[model samples]
Each structure stands twice: as structure tokens, then as C-alpha cells.
Target: MIPLRLKIETDAIEPYVVRLRSFEGISDESHHTGALDAALESASAETAEFSGATGNLRLFGVDPSEVNGDVLFVVPSRGTAHRLIRANSRHNTLLVTERCDQLCLMCSQPPKKQHIDMFPFFETALLLSQKNSTIGISGGEPTLFKSELFDFFNRAMSRRPDIDFHVLTNAQHFDRADLPILRRLDLTRILWGVPVYSSDSDVHDRIVAKPGAYDQVRRSLSLLCEAGAKIELRTVLMKPNAPGLLDLAKFVTTALPFVDSWAIMQLENIGYARQNWDTLFFDSSTGFDIVGKALDFAISRGIDTKLYNFPLCTVPTDYRAFAPSTISDWKRAYVADCADCSLRNECGGFFEWHPKVHGYERFGVA
Candidate 1:
């Protein structure tokens, strides 16, 4: 696993985004004012010195090679730095806010009443992102602050049109009122990942711990489709909604055919999920009949369907091709039994926190 935040000692007082510069010349100097020179040749891997207009700073307890050329958000008061854009990483995500209205049963990032607005810093970080990179915008729910979020998108995309964004939202906030602004944006460059658990309203609402969420999500999705927006319908598979997977697939193909793709995902063992594991964790390793049937049904209807965060071995051979390595590198991991597996490179393995004792029952070479 890779660390996202590292401790640093800097003299600067304000928050600023700076791209680390190695011995080589900077690639795109127009995005930022000055580069923080990263002394990668130093003998110690634990700490390295970085200097810029702000002053010299030491990044302690980290390998210099891992962060060289990465864009970092330095906060002097916290004495910590976040890698907003990694030079070597293909996956980059910016967490917009932590406040959400819905309290889902398996929310990986649990909601908090307090939210610190990071739109300004995120906009600057987006400008410093790598060329033609697809960045992910995730949160408790990004649409909570719809106005500022829209403004951030407009400003960031206007300056960096080459970058594409995949924003994760609950799809409960959008209404007909947001059509004008939504239509004006470049819909082709943005893909909204909206979650729809089940076709049954009672089941969907029960899973999210919100009343009438199913109807609201359907309405919001219709609005998005009318606005010519690209969307990726996301459904996290769990025990509560596992049986209705096929029904949801049928509903998606019949009622929401405009969705660009449908992604069925596994639950991560964190946040609220950790507390509800016994009831929510569905072991698809041995019981993949329902999931496979749903994928087949969606694919037969000409809808692009995929399985996210599922290890290749858990899926049957016929459906293995549909499961890509979708886990982000930072939290993706493998077990000792997988060391000798022939498909380790092609498999997503598991989440770093996936329970080794009571997790997948069937584990072997594919």
C-alpha cells in the first residue's frame, strides 16, 4: 500500500500547491509559480529536503522517490502534506467534502456534520494535474455544496480542458433547476457515478437509511439524462440487496437506458461497513449466481456492464473478462495465498482491510 499523506516541516504559513522538482527540468512551468526542488539523490530514504520560494522543508519518514515530481498540498499548521497528483500514479482523486444527507449502511467514508471547504485548493490542484489524466472526485457526497462545486468545475475545466473527471454522488440533490448550468458544462468530459442499489423502493431506501431515496434518485437520473450528461450507474453489492440485482438490471435497461455504463462493486471493509460486516458482507466467491446472472442480463441488452473491486478468481471463467483491476493502488492489496497465483498481475486482489479470517472462502489459482 502507498501512503497519501506525509509529515513535513515547512516555514510557510498558508496552504499552497507546489509540484516537486527533481534534477530534471520542470515539464509544465505555466501551471505553478515555482517548483519545490526535491533532493532525490540524498543517501537517507527516510527524509529528504525540498526548497522553493517559500523556503526549505524536510519531508520525514517517507521514501523520496515515491513523492518526487508529485504535486503536494502543504499545510504548515498541521505539519502535513498531501499528494494531490502523483507523477507515477495513474489514479488520482480529490475529496471535495465530507458532509452527506444520506446515511448509507455500507458507506466507506462516513458522513460528518462539519465540512471544510477545499474547493479553492482542489481547483489549484486540478490545474497542476498530469496531462490528459482522469481524476476522481469523491466525498460523503459532492453535490451537498452544489453551487461551489459547480463553480469549481467551471473554473478548473476552463483552464484544464484536457482533464476528465469522474465524480461520485448519491444522485439525490439534482433537480430540474440545475439543468441550465449542467447543460452548459462539457458533459462529455465528466462522468457522474451515481449509486442505485435496487429496483425495489423499500429495499433501496432501507439500505441507504433514507425514506423515498429511490424515487428521488430516479428523478435526478432522468434530469441528468435530459441534460445530455454522461453517467456511470454504480451499485455496491451487499447481502441486503443481493437478491434484487437482476431486478435492478432489468430496471436499468428498461427505464434508464441512457446510462453510459453499469458498474457492480464489492463492499469495502471500512467505516460503517466495519460495524455492519456480519449483516452486509456478501461473499460472492462461492455464491456468484445472482451477480453473474445480472451481468449477463445487462450485457445481453447491449448495456456496458462491469464488475468493480472484485478479484478475478471470485468470478467464473466466463465472466472473468468483465472484471477489471478497478481497485485504486493506494488501498489495493493481496494475501499470501495469492503470491503463487498465476493471475496475480491481472487480479485486483482485495482491499487492504479485507478480513483475512472470515473473507473469501474459495481462494486458489484460476
Candidate 2:
């Protein structure tokens, strides 16, 4: 048996077993806690042939068996920090709905339930809003259930007008109907965050898995801005869209001047991710190209820009400014790649799925 070395990411909430070798080894079937040694033993050996160098290895078993070694790691972000702060965070996510006209390739939740009564969600959000200055409402698509959507929005804002509510939408439905309620909501207080995968209509439509989605999103954005509603445009980078990434940001900077800001998120590894992993995900090494270009483009236009899920790559070498933001650290993909990184503390690390699929060991110096 090849003695397998195990690597673990510590950023995880619950400790997990890291097994780099195959399960076929050793003796006592019942006595063994699977392949993991209850107590980690220690050793050192060359890890990657590419580096032609050795890394210290910690063993967690009494038996000295030979097996493949695996590396596991974790890095926390603002989102993880916030979840840690609140005791009831387990009850705190806003699953606005399971309904959405566009089928984004990365839709975290599908059109599972379609519509939801705002009361159920509002009952919970109202309590959190008291303590949180900003409450972000994410969904199968928040705009789908307009009345219930605004119903909760109204209740929260009414109770604490000082609190800011943010709603993420595909921006498909809000435009066509000329409802007074949609316009009545104070744009000054609410933030309507929109998702645009690409600028090209054809690219955007296919990626969304819905035709004509580009037109609707385009029109809704125009209407939302015209009605004086605050706007935030977001883009999630993927393999297919990597090349034209900066163009999307360029379009928003030129056309949607009303958008309060722009944010570029690296694709996470989860849900529909594995099915599309070969095409949807990009490693952090390849990612710096896309991020560096987009950041420069948005900054040239004087728009506030950000990169979530990766601060190790995004931090400025000379000086920096900090803004509060929440991001998912891919527990499934986060890599221990940033080991010995200069900006590890400030960096949120990659999505778990990212490192799981791409391997954190490959992530290296620029």
C-alpha cells in the first residue's frame, strides 16, 4: 500500500477527513476509523513532481501504510465571518423563490417551488434586520413574486427605515408591467441587483438557457434606472465567457451609468457546477488574467469595482481601500493553494468547489 498523505483546509466549520489514498489497506476493519488515523503521525516527502520538492506530511494513523496523499485546506471570508457572528444564522438565508424566467447555467436553486409567501421569509428577516444594517435578498429570482417580494420589503423598511434592503433579480418581470407599486418603493433605500453574464445578446441568451433574455434584461435595466431605482450589476465568470469578460464590464460602464457599481465573481464549485465543471470553472492561476483586465477596465471608467472569492489575487500591492461585502467560500472547491500567501488573512480564499475540481496545489506565484 502506498502511504497516502492527507491535506486539510482549516477554514471549514466542521472538520472533515482528508484521504489521499485508496481505501484498500490494512487490518482491523471495525477498530479502524475508516482510513484516517484518529491521531495524526508525522513524515516528510516530495509532494509534486512539477515542483520537484518535498513538503512536510502529518500522519493520523499508527500503521505505516503506503497510499496516495491528498491536500485539503480552507480560507474564510466576510460571509463566513457574518455567519459566525449571529447565533441563529442557521435560520437566516433569504430563499426568495424557486421561479425564474431565465435558466442561468449556475442557478443555485431551480424553479423548484416557483412562488413563496413573503410572510414566511419576512417573519425571519424582520428579526435579523433589527441587528443587520444590510439584508441581501437572493432568490430563484426575487422579482418573480413582486407583491410578496415588496410585501416583506415594505414590512422591514417600515419597521426600520434606516436598514437597507438589497434584492437580486434577473430584471425580467419588473420592466413590462407599469405598476405604481414597483415605482413607489423608494429607490433611495432599496438596491436592485441585476445579473448579466455577457454583453452579446446571443452569448447571454445561451448561457441563461433562455432566448430573448438579453433584451428583457436590457430593457428592465433601462426602466429601473429611469424610475430612479438603485442598480448594481453583477457578472459571474465562467470558461465560455472568460475571453469576453472585460467587454461585459465595459458595456455596463458605458451604457448603464446609473448602476451604483459592478462586481465580478469567480464561478463557484457547487450544484450544477460538477455537471458543467469542465466548461464552467477556471482555476485561480487562469483567473488572474480575467480579474486583472476587468478591474482595470472598470477603474478606468471611474466605477467602483470588486472581485469576490479571491482577495489573494485582488489585493493591491501598494495601497488599498476596504468595503464590506459577503461572499461564499467554496467549501467544495477552496484550495490550500494560498499557503504562505502574503494576503491570506484579508483574502476570502476560493470557493470550495474551485479547489476541489481544480486542485489548490496548482495555484501559485504570479
Candidate 3:
């Protein structure tokens, strides 16, 4: 049986659905769209046997013990997005090396060019593992140490098979050596986070500081897709990549069919981003409109996407997100706008420095 993901439109509605699922064996459920009053309690000790629950779908209080025991594999909530996140609220990312092939302007970390060994890094990660483990092997580029990454995964998998893995790599590392690693790693438990700046290679390579980065991306993309590794194309949407937004969306939709999702992030005011904010960052003025258009295009293409840093109100209707609309829109800051905005209470708002760059006027009547 396939994993079932339930979708409930609103947070308010999630609870009631949870209540309804507590009953034994719900039959003839209504296939409805949109959010409702949602209630969720802790799972009951009395487990129900079921299977195949995933993706925008909730098991509500459905027990995983029930799931493992039964062949059915998943007892699904009628319509909720599958929350695939592991129950344990921890993630481990081992910095494989400081050495990066690229000089991305937005990198939060200082430049690391010398290749670092993996033995100590691997040991630390192993020590940090708890029951439900999700680990990301990050680096200037993890693939740079293709041999080390493969070896570490083999060791990690031997000890824990259920562990979910996220391999952060610049698609540039796809080569014969890398193939063996891809072959050895199980796809179900792994998510390859590959940074793809814009659909255009020129834009992507420019960010990576490697001129031929695009060629590597193209070849590796084919290999990653062929290997069936679940891939999430991490596209950092910035002022430079902004012009190619529509093209990027269409490119992903058309070219990277194997990609599981795309993370369209706004340039954060960190690392290279801080230095390049005037040139790279975008607030509501021109940035918001462009992002809204790109996002709309992505949705139209039936592409799965995520918006980070941007506030909620600034986003168009197509974007299904919980983030604030503008940098200045967040409540965390002691900014001037929050006092008058009706959304202040519910909104998570934006980063503290938002108002410093894109001030209150951008989010008018706030």
C-alpha cells in the first residue's frame, strides 16, 4: 500500500480531524478541501494497525507501532499534508570540510578551501545520534570528499538503517567515484540537497565561483535522477538570480523532473549576503513583486516550493506558507510598523534588521 498523506487546509481544522480519527476505523470520509478546526492529542497506547501514511497527510494519534506491525503500513487522515519529519526535534550536520570550490556571496560561514579529513567528523556524528536520526553531511561541498562521504554513510547505515540522511553537495561532484556512493546509499532515507541558483548555468556558476559548475550540475543531475535519490533542489533566490525567476521555475519544472522539491530562499543578511545586501537582498519594493511572480509561475507549473525570509502578507495567494511577508513585517523586532498592523499578533514577522533596510513604508498601513 502507498503512504497516505492527509491535507487539511487550515491549522484551526487540524484538531477536529484529529478528534475524528480517534474513533475506530473511520469509513466513507468526505474528500474535502480547505482548512477546518483541528485537534490533535498524543497517540493512544491502544494502537490501531494500519499502513502507508505520508505527504500533507496526518495519522493524527495513529501509532507507529501499529504501522510497523501491520502489512497495510499506514492509517491515514483523510486530507492532511503528510508531515514526514521525524518525531525527535534534532538534526545533525557534520561540516565535512572548510574547503569549498565556490565562493558564494551568501555563505554564512567563513571560506574553507583546505580539504578536511572525515574520520573525526564521522566520529562526532556517530556520537550525536539518537533513536530517530536525520543527519546532513554538509561541506564547502560534501562531494569534494566523495570517498569520505560514501565511507561514512556505509558506517552510519550499518549501525542505523532507519536514519534519514540529507547530503548537502554542489551538484558539481558527480563523477565515477561518486557513483558508487550513490549506489550504496538507500534512496528512501536520503535527501540530496543540491544548490541550483537559477535555471541558467551562468547564474549558478557565477555564485559557485567555478565557471564550469553548470556542466557538473547537468551531469550529476542526470546521475542523481537515475540513481533515484530523493533530491531537493535548493535555489537561493537573490537579486542577481531575480531576473531569471520565471526561467528558473520553468527550468526546474521541465528539466529536473526527478527533483522532489525546490527551496526558494531569500538572501539572508549573513556571510556574503551581508556584504552584498544592497546588491543581492530584496525587500517588498521590487523584490516582493518579483518573488510573487516567480512563485505564481512555479505553482502554475505544479511545482513544490518553499519561501523563506519573506513575510506572509507580501506573498501572493498561490504560496502556502507560514512566514511573514516582509523583513520589517515580523513581530520579533522593535520596529515602528508592528504597533498599527492588525497582523502583528498572528504574524511571526521578519528579521530584526528588516526595518533598517526596507523600512515601514514598504509595508504600508501596518
List candidate 3 stretches off by more than 4 Å: 1-91, 114-118, 284-286, 317-361, 364-366
- Compared with the true structure, what per-residue lDDT tens digits does model 1 show for residues 1-366? 899998988888897777775544445543244444333335265677777765767788876656766888888999999998897888899888888989999999999889888888888777767799999998989999899989988998999999999999999899888999998899999999999999999999999999999999999999999999999999999999999999999999999999999999999999999999999989899879999999999999989999999988788888989999999899999988789888899999899998877477876777
Please report how far candidate 1 places residue 144 from its true position, in Å. 0.6
The C-alpha TM-scores of every prediction are: 0.95, 0.67, 0.65
lDDT of 3 by residue, 237-279 (tens): 7767888887888888888766887777766555677777777
Error of 2 at 63 (Å): 35
lDDT by residue for model 2 over 312-332, one digit each (tens)? Answer: 444444312322224532132
Please name the candidate that would achieve the greatest lDDT relative to the true structure.
Answer: 1
- True-structure RMSD for candidate 1: 2.5
**Which model, 1 or 3, shows the larger lDDT?**
1
